[model samples]
Target: MARSPKDVSAHFSDVAEVYHDLRTTDQEPIISIKNQLGHLLYKPSINAADIGCGNGRYSLLLPQHLGDRLRLTFADKNRCMLNMLTKRLDHTCSSEVIQSSAECIPVCEKSFDFATAFNAVHHFKLKDFLAEMARILKDGGLLFIYTRTQEQNRCNIWGKYFPDFCKKETRLWKERDFCRVVAQTSQFALQDSVYFTYRRVSSLERLIEQAEGHHYSTFWLYSDKSFREALDRFQQNITAQFTDPAKIQWTDENTLFVLKKIREAR
Candidate 1:
C-alpha cells in the first residue's frame, strides 16, 4: 500500500523512526486547522477522520481542542507511519489508525461528519480524492485542506535561497486548481480559501541541520551533488543578504481550502 520509493512517503518511511526529531515541533499549519475548527465542531459528539494522518501529529494535538467526546479515524498510506502513531495513541483518544491511500479510502459511505487533509493533498490524485471525500462525508459535512500553493512555495526561504528549490518540487497545486476541481466535483462547494503567513525564526546552524536531514520532502528531489551545491549556494546567499546569521527570519505562507458537502455523492 506504500507509494513509490521516490515518493515523499518512502523518504518518510526510511526515516520514520527519527522523523519527529527532525520535524519542526510546532507547525503553524496544524495549529491553524484546529483554531479554524474550534468554531465549527460544536456538537457534543463528533466523528472525524484525519486523512493522510502521517505519524498522527494532528491526531495527538487534536484531542485538546476536540475533547474526549471526539472519535477519530486516522488514515495514511504508510504502514510505518501508522505503526509509529499507534504506540503514541494509547489512551489518548477513541481513535483508529488505518493504512489507506487518499484516492481510495476503505470506509463506508457517509461515515465522517468532519474530514481533513493537512499538508498531504499533494500526494493524492485530486479527482479521485475529492470523490472519495464526497462519499465519506455526510451532507453538509466539512473538509479542511491545509497546503501551500506553488506561488507560496516560491516565497519560502528555501525557494528564495536554494537553487532550483521551487523548480524541483512539482507536486503542489495552486489555489485556482483546487477551486476548479471542487467546482467540477459538483458534490461539494468550496466555502472559503484562507491564506496565512507565519513569521519564522531559526538560526543558520539549525537551518543547515534541517536541510541536511532533508526535513522537507523537497530536498529528496535533488541528487547528492545538486543538493550539496544548492546547500553551499543557499548558505552563501543568505549570509550575504543579512548580517545577523544567528537570528535568521523569514515568512512562510500556506492556504486552507474549506469545502462543504452541498449534496450527496452522485
Candidate 2:
C-alpha cells in the first residue's frame, strides 16, 4: 500500500541519519542533469531547485559538474533530511535549504530557472506538485523528472523475484498519464522523454542486507511479518535462478521527462 503523506514524511525523518548509507543512488543524476542543462543556451546564472532533495543525493555533486554559475536550493518536507544534507555539503557552492513539501513550495512566483525531481515524484500528489512547479518556475524554465514508471518498475530485479514487490508499489505513474498530465496543465510543454537502463551486479548477501535495512521506501509499505516472509522467498528464488550467488545480474530502467514552462500560471 502507498503510505500517507504523514507516514512518508515520518519514514524519511526516521531514516535521515543513515539515508546516504541506506539509499542507493540507483542512477547518477548529475550526469543527466548536467548534459540536459548544457544543451540550453548559455545563461549567466542558473537558479535551480532540487525538490524532494533527500540527503542531497543528486544535487550535492551538481556544483562541481556545472561550476559556480549554478545556484541551488534543496527543498524537502523532512527537516532531518535537510540537516543530513547540510553536513554532506562543504559550503563551496551557493545554495539554500528549505523545509517544504513538493505539493506546496514556499517561494516567490517564477523564481527558479530550473527545477529537477529525481526519484522523488512517486511520493507526491502528482497534480498538486505540477501546479506548484508551474507557479514557481519562470517562463522557459525547465523541469527534469527522473523516475521509474509503472512499466519500468516491473523490470527491476526485485519486481521479478521479490514476491508482491511490484503489486505493492502502486504509486508509480504510467508513462502515457505522465505525459498527458504535463500537457493538460497548459503551463508546461513536454520537451523530451528518455529511458535510462543500468546494468546492476550484486551479491545475494548484499541484496538481502539492503532489503532488510529497508533501503527503499517500498519495503516500508510491507508489514514486518510480510516482509520477513517475502525476504525468505526472495533469497531462495535468487539462489535457484542465478548460477552464482555473488554474480547475480539484472537491468534496472528509469525514465526522464523534460518539460519547459510555456506560460505563467495565473
Candidate 3:
C-alpha cells in the first residue's frame, strides 16, 4: 500500500519525545554525513536553513564545526521536534525555530547562505521543496541533501526484519535514480560533493531499539499488531543472521550531495 504523507508526518511527531533518547548513538554512516556537511561549510559569516531539522540535530552539530559564524533557522513540519530542539539549544548561537513543511518554507527569498536536510529528503516534496530552498538561499548558496543508500546495513537491519516494515521501507525510499533527478532539478546546479562510506559496529538488540524511534520508524503507522508482528519476525531474522547477536554488527553506506544554487536562473 502507498504511504500517506500526513500519516507519516503524524507518526514521527507523535514519537518525537522518546525518539532521540532511544537513538542517541548514530551509526558511522550518519556520523560521516554530518561531518561531511560540516566540512562543506568552512567559511566566514553566513546564514543557513536546516529544513526537516528534526530535533535540530544538524542545527546544533553544524555550528560546532562550522564555527560560530552562522545564523541558523531550524525548520520542520513537526512542532514536537522543533520544540525539543528549541529547549535543548535555547541558549546557544543565533537561532530561530520555525514550524513549517519543506514544501513551503516561510523564510524570504535569497535570505540564507545555505540550506540542509539530513535523512529527511524522502519525506519532502522534492520539486517544490528544492525550489523553495533554492529561492530562499542567496546567490551561490549551498544545499545539502543526504540519505542512506541501502537499507540493509546492520544499522538499519531492524527495519528489514519485519516483513511489514521491510515492505513499507522499500517502497518509501528512493534509489539511485532519484539522486540523478535531484541533480538535474531546475532549482540548483550540482556542485562539488563527496561520498563517504563507513561501517558502524552495533549489537543486534541495540539496533532494534534504535529502529523503534529513529527516522525510519515511520513504518509504525501500521496497526500495533502489525508492527509488533513485524518486529517479532525481524528479531527472529536477526538471530538467524548472527551467531552471537551481541557480537554481530553491520555496516552502512550513506551519501551526501552538496549542491550550489545558481544566483542567476535561466
Best by TM-score: 2
2 or 3, greater by lDDT: 2
- List residue ranges in candidate 1 displaced over 4 A: 1-9, 25-40
Please give, for residues 1-266, the per-residue lDDT of candidate 1 as tens digits. Answer: 32332455477787666667776544555566656665456778788899988887765777777788888999999988888888788775788788989988889999988798877898889989999998999888889888889999999889899899888888898778778989998888888788888889888998898898888888887777778899999999999987899999998888889888887546
Candidate 2 lDDT tens digits, 136-250: 9988888999899989988888999999988988888989988888878878888888778889898998898888767778888787778889999999999999999998999
Q: Give candidate 2's error at residue 238 in angstroms.
A: 0.2
Q: Residue 185 of candidate 3: its Cα lDDT? A: 81
TM-score each candidate: 0.91, 0.93, 0.83
lDDT of each: 0.82, 0.85, 0.68
Query: Candidate 1's error at 216, in angstroms?
Result: 1.2
Q: lDDT (0-100) at residue 111 of candidate 1?
A: 90
lDDT: the better of candidates 1 and 3 = 1
Q: Which regions of candidate 3 fall more than 4 Å away from where they truly are?
A: 1-6, 24-44, 150-155, 170-175, 212-215
What is the number of backbone collisions in each predicted candidate, taken in the order shown?
0, 0, 1
RMSD, one per candidate, in order: 3.1, 2.8, 4.0
